[model samples]
Target: MTSLSPTTRTTLGRKRNRAASDRETLYAVLDEALICHLGVVHDGTPLVLPTGYGRDGDTLYLHGSTGAASLRTAAGELDVCVTVTLVDGIVYCRSLNNHSMNYRSAVIFGRARALTGRDEKMHGLRVLTDHLAPGSWEHSRGVNAKEFAAVSVLALDLSEASVKLRAEGPDDEPEDVAADAAWAGVLPIRTVFGEPEPSADLPSTWSVPEHVRTRVSEAAAQ
Candidate 1:
């Protein structure tokens, strides 16, 4: 139950009861999520975009097209905010105002540095690729020089971060609980990976690989 030391900006302003100070919770939330919203201030205007990310220990990697202005600007000693959220269930309460969601979320604030060296860039790409499709990096084709040159990867250290989770049942008013008329409970939510469909151009005789098949089963079982 190691906890993260919260900074001024990382502190929650509202609903303090739901805040989670454990570092393990932050790591778990990030590892479980596929997409994260990246917020950056570009030219005095704030822009938030959903992007794929990967984590390696204390470093977070973000990749995108080299021509993307938002990412390009963010790489230049600019501060950014990255967030990942997972909804575990929907909470229904006796009153509409009390209705809420059971969720796990993490927010990270840091200045990102762009990777320029070939080795560093390749390693970053490997981390990102492996996170998205575990064994695909080793099984699939390698990145060519031209393709690698067209991509940009940014690395941010996870020093200032926070995790907040809400996993309790509905909290109804005392009077509502006495009445016991309204239905209240939690509806669980989950994301399951479906069977892999081969590309149309591929030969019909070709079968799915072991890694792909295993991932689908593992996701469903969870």
Candidate 2:
């Protein structure tokens, strides 16, 4: 994998206090995230939409209906932003103002262009499907030309991007710490997998696939 060099535009913050300058840290956060918020300007108005994305090397791929207004507007656009955030914990402080949540977020800015050609579209679709469910691509039916034509794919280059992370506990003043009237600590947050539900039409002998079973196991282990 090609490492992304941290540039002034890719720096974490203005003060660089909460910025995560390491390329590995940023890539890990993006890889672990499932959804991202896409920001675009339509007719001089700002709009943010939450959608699913997949990363391939230095580019991110987003898929949606060709008829969708937002996707249509974003195609061939020079101005766009994508953000992904993962909340890790809740910090409780003696004072309300000192309380803050621990989180990791990434912001990407670049031009987006619609992807054409059957080979690229098929590859994009596979990346998206596998990102959501690892090992699912081989198990499920591949996308046909008709289904591929109905969808639109936008590729965003990762030339300008930054990651910001806050993981410390609450910051309380000395006076507030002495008061100790309110609890001050961190409440860890996490994502978990529930029991798998089988489809109603499935045969009784059909068992859960290894991919899903492994996912549940890995989540539990984490």
Candidate 3:
């Protein structure tokens, strides 16, 4: 259980009790979240965009069209911040000021490098595919030369990162609890995969894939 050494940028100035100290916690938050916001500065202006990402050990991979200016800027050896968040529930407190939510979040800071080597690029793409679509890589065709040339991939290290989490129920004030001021509880939140819609062009005989069925079943069981 290696502790995540906090950097100057990652130090929690307030609510330090919510900060996570282990690298495992950071990895868990990243693995559970599907989308991340990537922040970088381009031409002296700050840009933050939500995008899909994949994790491989201590590295995070992001991909976009080669012509995207933001992607180009992020891969130019400049500092970038990436964040992932998962909302568990909404806390309804007795008082408005005490209202909050339960969530797990992570923030990573580092300069990303562009992946140019054929093997490395393919590896990164594999990681991305596995994370985003589970069994898609094995079931679908991989990238060809023209397709590969159209996408840009960047790899960022998880060396400097921070994780904060809150999972308990509402923290109503003592006075509110004693007086029974108002109702207080948690409204749990979740993401579930609905019924799969088959492509119109597909054969009517075709059925949903096992991998997809597994996903829906897992979500329902949760």
Candidate 4:
């Protein structure tokens, strides 16, 4: 496993042991996450917004309304901080202070550049769409010129980033461990794709596609 070279900004000062130094780990965490929080400074005040994103190789893409002020601001190659977090389980300890959660989180710090040109924009949007829904880009209708023009796409490099994860049982004080007065365990949490509910106007003959069915099964199995 190749480890990511730590920079002054990416180094962790607290709980350093939990920091993940591998780029593969960062990619895995990003791929598994469905949504990410984007942080940017608007009017000298920090603003964070939750949005869907996609990753291709070392670049992360984000899309939103073309007229959105936030996207407009970020499009000027503005500095931003993007983060994705996945909670795997809840850890219960004997003591409240010792309680924690098992999670994987990635933080990316970079400047976002706006994507232009129809081909580049289309490719960026396709990457975002495919990342969120796997095969939906091919299955769904193509985006028209008008629809494409109504949206904005931004790309950021994944070079300056960090990943940290915690996957373990509770760590309680020795006295608390011996006391054993409360339950201590881990309740696993995960994303489950339930049965797909078809659109009301769709014909009954249109059953779930094989790709979607397979995805649902895969999610359930995980």
lDDT of each: 0.85, 0.78, 0.84, 0.84
For candidate 2, the lDDT comes to 0.78
- Candidate 4, 1-222: lDDT as tens digits: 777756676675747888999999999999998988888887788878887789999899986542223545533676778889999999999999988999998989888777888887788999999888888898999889898887788888998988888999988899998988999989999988999999999999999998789889999889
Clashes of 2: 0
In terms of lDDT, the best-performing candidate is 1
lDDT of 2 by residue, 133-175 (tens): 8888989887776877778777788777877888998899999
Reference-based TM-score of each model: 0.94, 0.89, 0.94, 0.92
Model 4 residue 207 CA deviation in Å: 0.3
Give the per-residue lDDT of model 3 (tens digit) for 96-206: 999999998898998878788889888999988888889999888888999987777788899899988899988987999998969999999998888888989999998
Candidate 1 lDDT over 1-222, as tens digits, reads 777867877775846788889888898998889988888876788888888889998889987542223445533655788889999999999988899999998989988777888998899999999889989898999999999997878888988989888999999999998998899999999988998999989999889998899989998889
Q: What is the lDDT of candidate 3?
A: 0.84
Model 2: CA > 4 A from native: 1-15, 66-75
Where model 3 places Cα greater than 4 Å from the true spot, the runs are 12-14, 66-75
Which regions of candidate 1 are displaced past 4 Å? 66-75
Clashing pairs in 1: none
Tell me the spans in candidate 4 whose CA falls farther than 4 Å from its real position.
Answer: 66-75
**Position 176, candidate 1: lDDT:** 92
Every model's Cα RMSD, please?
Answer: 1.8, 2.6, 1.8, 2.0
